[model samples]
Target: MTRSHALFILMLSTALPQMALAQAPEAQSGDADILVTGRAEKLYRATDTEIGRGSSDPLDIPQSVQVITSELIRDQGARDITDLYRNVAGISASQYATVTYRGFRQDGNFYDGMRGDPFQGFAVPSLFSIERVEFLKGPVGMLYGASAPGGMINYVTKKPQDEFAASLRGIVGNYDRYGGSGEITGPIDKDGVLTGRAGAFYEHVGTVQRNSDTSSLVLDGGLGVKIGPDTKMTVQLTRYEQDLAGRLRGIPIDEDGNFLADRTWNHLEPSDYMKLNGTVAQMRLDHKASDALSFNLSSRWFRYKEDQDYHEPRPVSDTDGDGVPDTVTREFRRQHRNIEGVTIAANMIAHVQTGPLRHTIAAGGDWYWQQSLFDGVSTRAGVPPLSLTNPVYGLVPVGGYDLSNGSVERSDTRSHRYGLYAQDQIDWGRFTLVGGVRQDWFDDADPVTNTAKTSGKRTSWRTGGIYKPMQRVSLYASYSQSFEPQDPSRQSASVGGPFAPVASRQVEIGAKGELLGGKLQPTIALYRIVRRGIVQVDPDLAPINGVDQMSPIGEVTSKGIELTLAADITRDWVLTANYAYNDARITDSAPGAAIDNSVGGRFPNAPDHQAGFWTRYQIPAIDAAFAFGGQYVSGQLARSGAHMKGFTVFDGSVTKGLGFADLMIRIENIFDKTYATSAFDARRGAFVGRARTVFAELRVNL
Candidate 1:
C-alpha cells in the first residue's frame, strides 16, 4: 500500500467514533413492520426485504437475498450501485453495466421490481436518490419472468418522506472529480395528507485513462397522496443525462499476461464520443380492502436514446509465434439506438388462516412492452492496427457510415410479455412452506410492419420449506425454475424459427441467523444451477461482418457456496463480510461454435474464489467514525483459454461529525493496484481498474 494513503487512514482511525447509522435520525428503518422484529438497532444489519413482492422477513424467504442499506451506502461513500456489490457474494462485473451473477450474465439492473435496463446505452445509473439496493440470487423467473439464471438487482428509490427534511452533499477529488447534490422532502398539505420530494445531482470526472472524460446529471422527484385512510397513491419521475469522450474498452494482453501498454492508454481516437439521455416515470397505488387483505398496482415508463462512435479492439494474434501479441487490432464502430418501454403490474395480498395452517397468499399479473431501434456499422479491412509500445492517432474516419448497406445493419423491433403469477406462504408454528408459479407469453415483432417474427411461452415455478429451530433462526431448502425467450434474429434456416426459450433450474439449501438482539445477521448457502437452450452460430447461413445466424445447442452447470455476515458488535462497531466459491462450466455444446463457449470450458468472469470485508468503528463522544475494507478476486478464465490475473484493492475512510455537516476523507485502491474489471481474449485486452483515488466530501442535513 502507498505510504501516503496509509497515513491518511491512520489519521482517520483517531478522528472518528460511531457510524452514521448509529446516530443519524434519517437512518430509520424503511419498512414499517421491520422495526417490530427485535431490538437490532444497527443500520448495517438487515432484518427484512421486499424482494419477493411485499415486505418479508429475510429468514422466512428460502432464497439467498442481500441488501445494501442507505446507512451502509453513506458509511462506505458508495457513489453507485456497483460500489455496493463488493459486499454481495457471487457477483462479477465487466466494463459498464454488464454483470455476472453466480455464473450467468444479467443484461441490466431493475428499478422497483420491474425488469428493465438501467444502463441502457451508457446512461450508467448512479446513487443520488436511491433508498436501498436489493440483490435476489438465483432464478427469479417464477416472480420476474424470463430472466438470467444468476439473479436480479432491484433498486428501491427514495419516496416522499413523512416529515420535512433536507440534505446537501459535495465532493472533490483527483482526476478533476467534483460533484454536488441536494434533496428536500416534506408534507405538502397542512392536513399531512400530501407529501413530496425532489433531488438533483451532477458530476464531472476525468479518469486515469488518457483522453477519457465524462459527466452526468440526474433529476428526480415524487409525490405521495393519502386517499382517505385506506388508500395511497405515489407518482414519481426521474431524468438522466450523460456525455462521454474517449472511453476505454480495455487493455490488450499477451500470452504471458504482461501489460502491453500503460493502463491509461487506449486505441480510440481522441475525438470519439458517446452520449445517453433517458427519462423514467413511475406510479403506484395501494389500497387496503379490510384487515386481512390489500391490493397494489404499479406501472413504469422508460425511454432512452444513446449515440456512440469508437475504436473497438479485435482479437490479438501471435502469428509470429513470439509469445507476445503482435498488436491490438482496432476497428471503427458506430451505433445509434433508441429504446422505449412500459410496464404495468397488479397484485393482491391476503393474510388468512385455515384449520391447521396460516397462509400469506399473493397473486399478480404483469404486462410489459418495449420497442427499440438501433443502427450500427463497423469497418474491418481498412482499420489500422495499434502498436503495443507506441501508437499513432486519428487514422479512421469517425463522422461517416450510417447503418445502410452490405455490412451495416439496422434493427427495429418490438416485444411484449404477459405474465400471471401466484404465491402462497404456509405457516404452522415454526415451519413454513412457500410455493409460487408463473406463466408467461412472449411475442416479438417488427416495429415498422407490426408483423410477428416469433412467439413463445414458458411456465416457471418455485417451492421451498423453511424450518425455524429457534426464534430468529431459519434453515431452508428450495427448488426453482426460470426461462428466457430467444431473440427472433438468432433463428437460422437449419434450426428454424419457433425455438424454445432457454430454461434454467436450481436447487439450494441455506441457513440464516439473526442474533445479538438484531446486532448480527449471518447466512450460509449452497446451490447448483443448470441451464440449457444455448444459441450457436449456423454455418449453414452466410456471415455479415463475421456475425451469423444462430441455433440453440448447449448446456451449462454451476455450483457454488456463499457465506456472508453483517454484524454490529457494539454501538460503535459495525462490519460486513462475504466469500463465494463458484464452479461454472459448459457441459454440452455444438462441435464448432462462433465463440469460446465450449464444452468443459468455464464461464467468463465467474471467478472460482472471491471475497470482501469491511468494518467500521465509531467514537461517539467526539462524533467520529472510521471504516476499512478491501475486495479480492482469484484468477479466472475469460475466453479462448485467456485468463485474467487477480489482485486486491483496499479502501479506507474517516468521518467527523459537525453540528450541521459531516466531513469525510476516502481513499480508493490505496495500494494503487492494477487489475481488470473484465477480461477477454488476446485480441481484446482487459478493462483496466482505476488507480488510487483520494477524495473529500461534506454532507449537510437539516
Candidate 2:
C-alpha cells in the first residue's frame, strides 16, 4: 500500500481504543450529555431542537432533521452555508447562487425559524454570530406554510448569556486571505436581570478566479431583559456589507463538458463590480402565564440594497482550423435593486392531559410583507478575438460604452402573506401521535401600475406517529403537504389571470436509535414526494403569432433513503457519517415546460448517491487534536443535456491548545482535485472548485 494510506491506517488503529471506551455505559453517562462547555460543545447528540416549533427531541420529530452545531462548524472552518453541505445529506449547491435539496431548488432560507428572502442581493450570512444550523427535510408546510417540498434551512442566532465571557480570533489562509473577529457577552446590570452580547468580523479574501477579490464586514449585537419573574424580552440587530471586484463567474466549457479556458481566466473589465448591504432588527418576548402554559412573540424588520455592473463572456466562433473556440463576445449588464421586509410571529404552548393520554399543544400565527424595486440595463458588445494557445489581458477598456444607450427594464413589486397553524402531540405509554394544520393567505401588487397582480389562499396539513418499543429506539411515519406560489410575471398574457399555486405531498418513514450505550446516535429514513401543477406554456396554442398561452401540466417525483450516524465515542474521540440515495425525476410535463421532458429525466444537480465521513482524535498528553474527512458524490447531469463527472475530496486539520489560546491549521482539497462545484448550462460553463489550500487560525479566550 501507499505510504499515506499506511499512515492513515496506523492512526486509525491508535484511535480505536478510545472509540471503544466511549461506547461503554459508564462513559456515555459521564459527560457525554453535557450541552455546552466554554465556547465549544461536545459533538454526538443534541438534547432538543427548535426546528418544528419552540422545542422537541430529535427522536420525537418523525422526520429527517439534521443539525450542524456550532462546534462542528468551528472544527470545519466553515464560513457560510455552502461550506456545511458535506454534513447534510441529499443537498447540493447549484449555479445562480442556489441550493438543491432532495430534488427541488429551495426557494428561500429562514432565520431563527422565520422566513426570509435570500435573493435580496446579500451574500450568505456570516457564521460568527450563529449558534447552529438546522435542515428540516421534507414538507414543513403545516408549520411554515408555503415552501419548497424538499425542505428548508433555519439559522439559529446566538443569544446573550448571563455569564461574562469574551473571545478574539484571527485567521489567515492562502491566496492572500485574512480576517479577524471578536465577541463579548456579559450581564449589564448588578441584579443580573439584563444581559448583552456583541460580535463583529472583517475579512478581505482573494478568489481563485483571476482579477477577483471580496471584502466583507459583519456586526451583530443583542440585549436581553428580564422584565418580571415570568416575563422576558430580547432585541437584536445585524448589519452586513460585501463588495466584489472584477469577475465571479464560472469558466466556459465545450459541448463535451470539457473546460475550454484556464481555471483562473477572466473576461471582465476592471470597472465591473457588485456591492451588497443589509441591516436587520429583531425583537422577541417570552412570558410564562402558568406552570404548564407559555407564550412567545417575535418581530423583525430587514432591508437590503445592491448595485452591480458586470460583464459575461460568450463563445462566438472558431476562426482557426482547430475545433477549439477562437472568438468570444461580452454582455454588459447594470442593475440597482432595493428590498424591504418585515415579519411578526407569535405562538402559545400548553401542556395538558386527557384520560389515558398526555398532550403538548402549540398554536401560532405569522404575518409577512415585502417590497422590492429593480432597475436594470444591458447591452452586447464585441471584443477582439484572442488566440487560445497564448491569451493576452487588458485588451478592452473599462466602462468605455455608454450605459444609457442600452436596453432598460424596471420593476416594482410588493407582497403580503399571513398564516395560522396549530399542532398537537399526544403520548400514551410507548406510542406518540402528532397532528398539525395550517392556513395561508398571500397577495401581491404592482405599485407602479396601482393594480393588484395576484391573490391566493392555501391550506396544508401533516400527520405522524412514533412507536418506541425500546428506551433508545423510536420508529416513525409521517405524511405532509406543501404549496408554492408562481410569479405573476411569468404567467402568459393569454392565460387571462395569474397561475395558481403549485402543490406537493410527501410520505416518510424513519427510525432513530441511540446505540452503544447512548454514545452513538443513528438515524435512517425513507421518503417519497410528488409535486404537481407546474406552470408551462400551452403547446396547443402554438404561440399564435407570438402571443403564447400557459397552463399547469408538469409533475415531478422524488424518492430517497438516508442514513446518518453521529458518535462521541469517547471524551477525546468524535465521528460523523452519512449516506443518501435519491431518485428524482420529471414524471410528466407539457411540450413547453421549462425543462425538456424525456419521460423520466433526472433533476439537475441532484446526484443519485452521496456519502461523507469525518473523525477527530485528541491527545491530552500532547494537548492537540488531529482530524480528517472525505466526501463523495456520484456523477450526475449538469443540465438537461450535459453530464458532470463525480469526484472525491479529502481534508485534514490539526489543532493545539496553548494554555490561554488555541491554534489550528487546516488543509483542504489535499489531493488538488479538479472538479465542478456549479454549472451555468450544459454547454456553457461550470464553476471550478477551489484548489489545494491551507489556512491557520488562532483564538484567545478572556
Cα lDDT listed for each candidate: 0.79, 0.77
What is the C-alpha lDDT profile of model 1 across 1-702, one tens digit per residue?
Answer: 235533533443222222222324644433211112222234666667778977797888999988888877887888766687788899977557777789776666778888555466654568887898888899999888978899888889899977766666788999999977777776777787999887777778888887687887777889999997999999999887788884467777654455678888877778888888788899999999998899999999988888888778887655567786657776777788899999999989999999889999989989998888988787766677877666677765555434344257677888898899999999999999999999999988775644457887899999999999989999999999989887675543434555799899999999999876667788999999999887776666676656565666778899999999887766667778999999988887766663243314666777888999998877767778788999998886655456678878899998887765789899999989888777766566777877899999998665
TM-score of each: 0.89, 0.91
Give model 1's TM-score versus the native structure.
0.89
Q: Kindly report which residue pairs in candidate 2 clash with one another.
A: 22-569
Residue 236 CA error for candidate 2 (Å)? 0.6
lDDT by residue for model 2 (1-702), tens: 235533533443344344334434422322221123221124635667988886898888888988998778888888877778888888887754467788777647788888655344636666777889898999988989888899988889889987666566789999898987777676777787999887777777776667677787777789999999999999999877788773366666665556667777665556678888888898899999998899999988888888988776655467775866755566777889899999999999999989999989999999999988999888765434443335565576545666667889887899888999999999999999999999999988776755557888999999999999897789999999999887766553556447778899999999998876767788899999999888777687656556677777788899999999888767777889999999888887775366442323666677788888888888877778888998898876665356777879999999888765788899999998888775666324677887888999887555
Lowest-lDDT window of 10 residues in candidate 2?
32-41
Best prediction by lDDT = 1
Ten-residue region with minimum lDDT total, candidate 1: 31-40
